[model samples]
Target: MSCTSSSMDIVPDDTFNDFAPLSKRRRVSDCSRSCEDSSCAPLKKFWFPDGDIVLEIQTRLLKVHRRRLQCSVIFSDMLHIPQPFETDQIDGCPSVALVGDALADWEVALAWIYHHDEFLNQVVTFDILSGALRISTKYEIPGLRRWAIEELSSRWPVDVVSMRLNALPHAAEAITLAQECNVPEILPAAFYALSVQKFHASADGGRSHLVLSPNDLRRLIAGREALQDALLRIAVDPLTEPGCANNAACAHCAPRRAEYWRARLAPDPKSPWSTWLVRELDWMLRDDAFAGTLCPACFHGHMSTIKWRLGRLRGAMPGFFLL
Candidate 1:
C-alpha cells in the first residue's frame, strides 16, 4: 500500500473482533435525539467542531463538514433535502443516520474526508483499506474509491508463489471483501492463494461467515488439484539421458538433485508444495556451489528446463482461478 501524507496504524486483529453482523448491534431510532444525551455528546469532538452535519453511524456519532460531504455525489444529493424533521437533529445540526455499517468503517471513511492528507500518508492495512473501499463505494466517493482499488490492486500478487507469500494470512477475508466491494482484480490472486492453502469445504469449521462462497470454494478445489498435478508432472520428468555424462557426478549428484526437485514439487499430499519450495529452488539456481554439483552441459540443460517449466506453470495459474 502507498502512503500519501499522514498515516495511522493498521487496525490489529483483535480490533476486528469488534465487527459483528449489523443485525446484532443495538439499533438507534432515526428520530431526533438531544445533543446533551451522553451517547451523542462525545461524537461532537471530531475535526471541524463547528461542522454543520453529524452522522450517527451505529452507536457512534461523527461531526462532518457539509462541504466535505458535498464532495460525494450521493452525499451531496442526500444533504440537499430541505425536509428538516425528516432527519435527526443534534444541537440544531442535521444528523444523518447511517445504518448497516460498522463503526470502525465509518471512522475510517470520515477520517479520510476530514484528514485526507494524514490518512493517505499512513500505511494502511488490509482491514483499513477494505473499509475505505466499502464506504467510498457506498457514498459514491469516486476519488477515494479509486485510491482504495489501486492500493489493493498494486499489493495483490500476480503469481501463486507471491500470493502465498503476501496474502495467505488474510486470504479468506480479502476474498470476501473483494467480492463485496466489486474489486475483481484481487480475486484471481486471492483465490489462487486460498487454493494453494488447500480448499476445505469445512475449513472454517462451521464459521461460514469466515469462508468463501460455495461456488468460489469449488473453483479453488478444482484449480488446486489441477495445478498440483501439473507441477508434479513437470518436476518428476527424467533428468538423465544417453548423451549426458556417465561419470560419478551424473550417477550420484544428478539423482540427488532430481530427488530434491521432486520432493519440492510433489511433497506428501499432507505437506503440499509451498513458498518454501519456490525459495529453495531460487537459491539453488543462484548458488554457484549447488550449480557446480552437475556437469556444465547437464547443469545448464536442467536449469533451462526447470525455468521454462516454472514459467509455463505460472502463466497457466491465473486461468485455473477463473470462475
Candidate 2:
C-alpha cells in the first residue's frame, strides 16, 4: 500500500475512460488543453465536444444568433516541422551559441566541446569558455558538467546543428554549455536527408557535393541507440508514426507514455494514479494550478513497444538499468 509516483495517488483502468469519454455523437478524442499560465484557461469542452463545443467540425455556426465565441479553433495543419504536444516540458529544437572571452585560447577546448555536444545533438554555447575549460573530461568533476547535462536535458533540448552552422572556430566549452542547458534533436534519416540537401548543396564537375550520401545517412540512423536509462526513446518520425497528422519530435512523451498505465496498474494496493490524480486536482483547484485536463491516450500503443524493447536488452544487460 506504499505510495508511488511523484505524487502518491491511485486510479483504475476501468475508471480511466470515465474522465475523458469519447462522445458517441462525435466519435473522436476531445481536444482539451491545459498549461502552466495562470491567466490562460482550458476550454470547458473540447474542439468537437458532443454538446456546445466552441469549435467543432470547422462548420459554420449560426451567423445571425452566433454565441459570439471568444476564440477561434486554429487547426495547426503544419508541414515539415510543427510544434510538439503541449504537455511536454521541452521542445525538440537544438540551441547552440558562440561563447569565448575577448582573451582566451579556445582551440583545443572548443573542438573537443564541439565534438561532444555535436555528437549528442545537444545545446552548446561558447560564451562560458572559462566554465567549459573547468569541466574535466578525464577526471571526475562532480558538479561542473555532469549535473548541468542532467538539469538541461530534463528541462529542454538544444540543437547542436545550430551551433556548427552558425559559429566559427568551434568552441567545445561553449557547446558543452549549451548542451548543459538543453538536450538536442535526434534527426531522422528522412529529415537529415532533406536537411543535407537543403543546406549542403550538390555540385557537378568542379562543384562540391556537400550533401550526405544515402549510405552515410543510413549508417547514422543505424548507429543510433536508446537512452542509457530507457528514459528517452529517440525514434525517427514517420518510421513508427507513419499515419500521424501532426509534426514535431517528443522524446519524453513516448518513453514516458510507454510506462504510464503499467506504473498505475502494477497492482500496488495504494494505487498511485487514482489517489494522487484526485488529490492533485483538489489541491490544484484550490491553488489554481490546473483542472480536469489529463494526458490523453498518448500512452496507448506505446507501452508495448517500450516493454518489448526493454525485454530484449534486459535479459543480457547489467543491473544498473532504470527499467
TM-score of each candidate structure, all chains considered together: 0.72, 0.19
Q: List, residue by residue over 144-218, the lDDT tens digit for candidate 1.
A: 899898777666665544543555556777778888888877777776666656334334322323477887767
Per-residue accuracy of model 2 over 54-87 as CA lDDT, tens digit each: 2111221111101212111111110112322321
Off by over 4 Å in 1: 1-33, 37-48, 80-88, 198-209, 238-256, 266-288
lDDT of 2 at 146: 57
**Candidate 2: which stretches are off by over 4 Å?**
1-134, 151-197, 201-218, 221-323
> Which one is best on lDDT?
1
| Root-mean-square deviation of every model | 9.7, 31.1
Model 1, residue pairs in steric clash:
4-120, 5-121, 6-118, 6-121, 6-122, 7-122
